[model samples]
Structures are given as C-alpha cells and as structure tokens.
Target chain A: AQSVTQPDIHITVSEGASLELRCNYSYGATPYLFWYVQSPGQGLQLLLKYFSGDTLVQGIKGFEAEFKRSQSSFNLRKPSVHWSDAAEYFCAVGAQDYGQNFVFGPGTRLSVLP
Target chain B: DAMVIQNPRYQVTQFGKPVTLSCSQTLNHNVMYWYQQKSSQAPKLLFHYYDKDFNNEADTPDNFQSRRPNTSFCFLDIRSPGLGDAAMYLCATDQGGGNQPQHFGDGTRLSIL
Candidate 1:
C-alpha cells in the first residue's frame, strides 16, 4: 500500500518570507504525486501534479515542487508567500494503473503572519 | 466553465434522520467520487462511481450509501445520521484516464443535531 507522510503538522511563516512544505511517500513503484490547497470552509484546489518526465513541476500561485526519486520526497516550495496563501496543504500519491485512488498525507496547515 | 456542483452549501439534519446530498457535473467525467472531510482533517474517500460502477471503501459504514443514476449526477444517501457523520461532503469528477486530475465541487457542510 502507498502512504504519505507530511512531517510538519502546522507551519507559520511571515509574509514575504520563503516557504517549503515537506512531503514524503512510501510506494513500491513510480508514483504520481500532487499538491493541493484548501482554504477554511472550501474545497481543495490543485496546486500542481507530477506524472512523469520533469522532476521539477510548477504550480499555481507561484508555487513549485520537486520530485526526488531516491529520497522518495516531493516538497512544495515558494520564494515568497502572501497572507492569502494561508491554508491547508496536502500531498497525495497514486499510480496510473492502480485503482482510482490517491493516498493522501495527513496535511499541513499553513499560517502566514503579517 | 465546466465544473462540478454540489447542491445546498449547508445542510442541517437531526440525528437518525435520513439525508441525501446531490452532485452534478458539467465536465461529464466517467468517475465521480464522494469524500468526507472533518475539521482539520484530510478528505476521506467514501465511495466512487466509475461509469455507473460503484466502488465503496472497505471501512465505509453501511449507513453511507451512494447512487449514480446517470452520467452527470450522483447522490450520497445516509440512512441514519450520527454526530460523527457531520462533516463536509465533497464531490469530485475525473476523466477516468491515467494521470488525469480530479475536479472538486465546493462541498456541502452537513450538520447533525
């Protein structure tokens, strides 16, 4: 079974500061990874996804992530963050051939300070 | 824009009362999924329909049932609600292709009293 681990349960960063949210996965084969953001009282919005090819993927709202195969990690990074960027971040892993399922990490709550 | 839509942004039902949440999508994706998300938690998959084929999670309680009458619509029916059932019910759609992304609805907040 594939599982995800997000080391940080909650992260607080000052506005305009750079940020990085860590995500690690346990999968036997090459896995498809994704990053999503959910604001309070709202559904999730896809930040980006990694299928194959480029190890580095770019996402919306000035966000990006790199897939390190050997490390089994895909971490989200941003050079600077805004107050509106505060939300919950989730990293998910799935396989193209697997059943329509994505094992999601517990999630990381992001709070931006002014 | 083509998107997923869940009716009744907020629903309040009494305990033991039966409630149903409906989802419709303009994207016409073959796969539709229902997920439950509690406060400060990740979305938990309840079940999904793949071109009318219903797939329920192993641990999903029997009280939670789902129906997909056609391609564009799906419904989540709770036979008897409990406090634990109170959460945000979300609907999402996928193209049923490898590496395809799932689009989500705004979700319905169910409050059991």
Candidate 2:
C-alpha cells in the first residue's frame, strides 16, 4: 500500500514571500505524485503532477514541484504567494493497483497574510 | 465548457434522510470518483467507477453507496444521512490512466441536520 505524509498542518506566510510545502511518500516503486489545492466550499484544483522525467515540474498559478527519488519527496514551491493562494493543499501518491487508485495525505492549510 | 458539473452546489438534508447527489462530466472519461472531505481534512476516496464497473473502498460504510449507469453520469447516494457524513462531496474524472490529470467539479456541500 502507498501513503503520503505532509508534515505541516498549517503554514502562514506574508505576501510576496517564498513558500515551500513538504511532502513525502511511502511506496514500493516509482509512484505518480500530484499537488492539489482546495478553497473554501470548493472542490480540488490540480496544482501540478509528476509522472516521470524532468525532476522539476511546473504547474499553473506560479507553482512548481521537484520530484526527488532519493528523498522520496515531491515538495511544492512558489517564489511569491498571493492572498488568494491561501487554501488547503493536498499531496497524493498513485500506484498501479486496481486501476491507479491514489492515496492522499492529510493536507496542509496555507494562510497568506497581506 | 464545463468539463464536470455537479448539481445543487449546496445540499441540506435532515438526519436519517436519504440524499442523492448527481455528477455529470463533459470530458466523457471512463473513470469517475467520489470523495468526501470534512473540515480540515483531506478528501477521502469513497468509491469510483470504471465505465460500469463499481469499486468501493474497504472502509467505506454501508451508509454510503454510489451508482454510475452510463459513461458520463454518476450519483452518490447516502442511505441515512449522519452528522459525520456532512461534508463537501467532490466528483473527479480521469482518463482511466495514470498519465492523465484528474479534473474535479465544483462539488456539492452536503449539510446534515
């Protein structure tokens, strides 16, 4: 079974400040990783995803993540964040079992200050 | 165009009442998933369907059930609404493969009174 761990429960950062959200996964083989953001009263929106090749992957809304096999991590990063960026972020790991079922982390809540 | 559409952005149901939420996708993906997200928690996968094939999570309680009659339509049925079941129900669709991204609908905010 595959699982994801997001150490940070809540993160607060000022506007224009850089941010990094840590995510680690436990899986037997190479897994597909994804980052999703959900605002209040809304469903999740895909921030980015990493399947293979190119350790660094770019996503919408000025977001990026690096897939490090050695570290077993795919941390989401942004150089500058807007107040609208404040939301709950989730890290997910997908495996090749039962038609690519994904296991998700608890989630990290981000609060951006003005 | 709306790739995924969930009817009744907000839904309120009485305790022990049965409620059904509908999800329709324009993407026409073969795979559709239903997730339950509580306050300050990650979205938990309740079940999913690959075309007409239904798959439910082991931990999913009997109170929760799902049905997908066609390729583009799916429904999440809550037999007996409980306070714990009150949460935002998200509908997502993928191309039935790992390489494709899972697109999500706006979700239905289910409130149990």
Candidate 3:
C-alpha cells in the first residue's frame, strides 16, 4: 500500500523567512508526487508535481520541491514566504496510472507572522 | 477558463433528512470524485465517476450514493444525514492519464442539525 506522511502538524514562520515542509512516502515503485495548498474556506490548489526526470520541480507562487528518491521524500520549499503564504499544505502520492487513487498526507498548517 | 464548480458553499440540514450535493465541471475531464473532509483532517475519497461509471470506495457507507448522469456533472446523495456526516464535501475533476493533476472546487460545508 502507498502512504504519505507529513511530519509537521503546524509550523509558524515570520514573514520573509524561508519555509520548508517535509513529506515522505512509502511506495513500491517510482511514485508521482504532488504538493497542494489550501486556504480557509477554499479548495486545494496545485502547487507542484513530480512525475519523472528532474529531481527538482518549480511550481506556482514561487514554490519549489525536490524529489529525493533514495530518501522517499518530496519536501516543499520557498525562499521567502509572505503572510499570504499562510495556508495548509498537503503532500500526495499517486500511482503511475491515473486510475489509481492518491494517498494524501495529513497536511501541515502554516502560520505566518507579520 | 476550465474549472470545477460545486454548489451550495454551505448547507445546513436536519438529521435523518436526505440531501444532495451537485458538482459540475467545465474542464470536461473524464473523472470526477467526491471527498469528505473533517475539520483539520485530510480529504477522504468516498466515490468517483469515470465517464458515467460509478466507483465506490471499499469502506464507503451504504447510505452514501453517487450519480454521474453525464460527463460534465455528478451528484452525491446522502440518504440519511448523520451528525458524523457534518463535514466539508469536496468535488474534484481530472483528465484521466498518467500524472495528471486534479482540480478542486471550494467545497460545500455540510452542517447537520
């Protein structure tokens, strides 16, 4: 079975500070990794995804994630986070086939200080 | 622009009453899914439709049913609203293929009275 784990439940960071959210997955084969952000009373927005090739992938809103196959980790990072960046982040793992359902992490709540 | 839309951003219903939530997509994706999310919890997949074919999760309750009348619309019906069913219901759509991302709607918050 495939599963995603987000180690941090909640994180507080000051504005303009760097942010990193950790995500780890357990899968038998190479996995499709994704990061999504959700604001209060809103749906999830795709931040970035990794299918194959490049270990590092850039996403919208100046977010980026590096896929480390050996460590089974895909961590999201932002060089400078703004107050608006405060939201819940989820990491999901999916099979290579689209028909397969995705397993999502519990999510990390980000709180940005002004 | 292509997008997924879910109706009734907030709904309040009496316990044991039947309620239906609707979802429509302009993306024309082949797959539409329903997910239930409790406060501060991850979204849980209840069922999905792949081009009119309904697929239910193994643990989904018998009271939960889904209907995809066509490619663009899907409906989730709760036969009896329970207090435990009070949560945010999210609708998502995706083009079925390798590595395709799913688009989500703002979700409908269901409150049982």
For each candidate, what's the DockQ? 0.63, 0.68, 0.74
Q: Which of 1 and 3 is the better model by DockQ?
A: 3
Look at candidate 3 and tell me the lDDT of residue A63: 99
Top DockQ hit = 3
lDDT of 3 by residue, A8-85 (tens): 999999999999999999989899899999999899999999999999999999999999999999999999999999
Per-residue C-alpha lDDT of model 1 across residues A33-98, encoded as one tens digit per residue = 999999998888999999999999999999999999999999999999999999999998876674
> Which portions of model 3 miss their true places by more than 4 Å?
none
Predicted candidate 3 versus true structure: per-residue lDDT over B1-113, tens digit per residue:
88989999999999999999999999989999999999899999999888877889999999999999889889999999999999999999888753778899999999999
Per-residue accuracy of model 2 over A18-93 as CA lDDT, tens digit each: 9999999999988889999989888889999999999999999999999999999999999999999999999998
Q: What TM-score would you give candidate 2 relative to the actual structure?
A: 0.96
Interface RMSD of each: 1.7, 1.7, 1.3
The whole-model C-alpha lDDT of candidate 2 against the native structure comes to 0.92
> Which model, 2 or 3, shows the larger TM-score?
3
lDDT: worst 10-residue window of model 3 chain A? A94-103
- Model 3's chain B yields a TM-score of 0.97
* DockQ of predicted model 3: 0.74
